[model samples]
Target: MFKKVPILIFFFLIFFVSFEDLYSKDEYFLTLRNEKVNLRQGPSFDYPVKILYKKKFLPVLIQDSSDNFRKIRDHENNSGWVHISQLSKKKAAIVIEEELILFGKSTIFSNPVALLKQGRLVKINKCKIEWCKVKTGKYKGWVSKNGLWGLL
Candidate 1:
């Protein structure tokens, strides 16, 4: 019994420390996992649905959490509660500029493939100094980093 005490304490400390790092310190970026999720006024299903998020991989700021529910703020500054299960750790970004040109490569000389309007959501695959490789469905290209949000 005495020999088991130190072993148990060691395991408990390891578990606690790792669990502490599992959640965000204050605010962190999370993405919508499903194509559609319901945002409610409160942390429980008893609350009425306040909005419907139909965009998958949309970046959202997690401001608070209670149990399995998390309070999130969208790019439009809308606040609501969503179930944590509907959220993913994948990072994404929203186009903040009124209009942004999606380039074929990460340079101004690259051919423009599409024009992304503001509020458009794209998964951030990687980023460089002033450009980010983004994708939404079949649209994959680079966009100026200055026009995006949800990155550090």
Candidate 2:
């Protein structure tokens, strides 16, 4: 009976901790699933649309969540509410500089693959300390972490 009581207590503690973590209001990264998503001034559709995001896979920082909407900040530092269904868990990033050189390798001295324009949305494959591997269409390369948004 004593051993069983200790095991039950351990299981309860683990469950409670996991549940709290699931509901915590922590900031997270999300990508736009659709090519065209509307950012509104408020959580509901009744609010006026403030911005139109035309690029799919654009990463946004989720600041808060309402019943069916999420308050998000884009790479351009614009804050608006978007429908939750428009967001996806798939990782992605947006180029923040006027232009960025994608390197075949992680370093600048390495071969340049392409010149990516600002606001280009790319799927994030992985990230290191100073660079992240991204892909858009047929191009896949690494961009400096300094010029990207949504690397956390």
Candidate 3:
């Protein structure tokens, strides 16, 4: 019986490592599931004025639970809840290069931003909108919607 002690310990260790994967936060890659999503100010359709999150867009901030609402923070640090049905899970390319630009500051408007690195993730903010916003290095800002991705 003593000879089996080490084997049992090895199996126990393996189980412990894999256990974390079960409880880890569920992550989903955004996909353009809907034709359009409105970025409302409140959780329900009754909310007040706020910018619109148009169609076929990918947002940097992702949500998986259909809680009917999502708490979000704007670049100005404003916080509020919005309707989850008004959003989609579409993924896009984000520039990860060390050097990048703030879309508003650039003039080209077409290909104003460049020097993007590989493997960076960007949620197309709004394709129809004039400016597109992206999330990189934990920071969110606007980019031209026509360039590559749309506003989510």
Q: Please give, for residues 1-152, the per-residue lDDT of candidate 3 as tens digits.
A: 98899999999988987786654444333433455555556667688747644434443343333358665543223345556655555556444344455454324454444444433446644444455566655556665444442223
The ten-residue window of minimal lDDT in model 2 covers 19-28
For candidate 2, write residues 48-90 as lDDT tens digits. Answer: 9999999888889999989999999998789999999999999
Better of 1 and 2 by lDDT: 1
lDDT of each: 0.92, 0.91, 0.50
Clashes of each: 0, 0, 13
Off by over 4 Å in 3: 1-36, 62-67, 74-79, 96-114, 117-152
Q: Single out the weakest 10-residue window by summed lDDT for candidate 3.
A: 57-66
Q: Each candidate's root-mean-square deviation in Å?
A: 4.8, 4.2, 11.0
TM-score of model 2 relative to the true fold?
0.77
lDDT of 1: 0.92
**After superposing candidate 2, which stretches have Cα over 4 Å from the reference?**
1-25
Please state the error at residue 40 of candidate 3 in Å.
2.3
Ranking by TM-score: 2, 1, 3
lDDT of 1 by residue, 1-112 (tens): 9999999999999999887877556688899999999999999999999999998888889999899999999888989999999999998999999999999999999999
Name the candidate, 2 or 3, with the larger lDDT value.
2
* Candidates in descending lDDT order: 1, 2, 3
> What lDDT would candidate 2 get against the real structure?
0.91
Of 2 and 3, the candidate ranking higher by TM-score: 2
TM-score of each candidate? 0.76, 0.77, 0.35
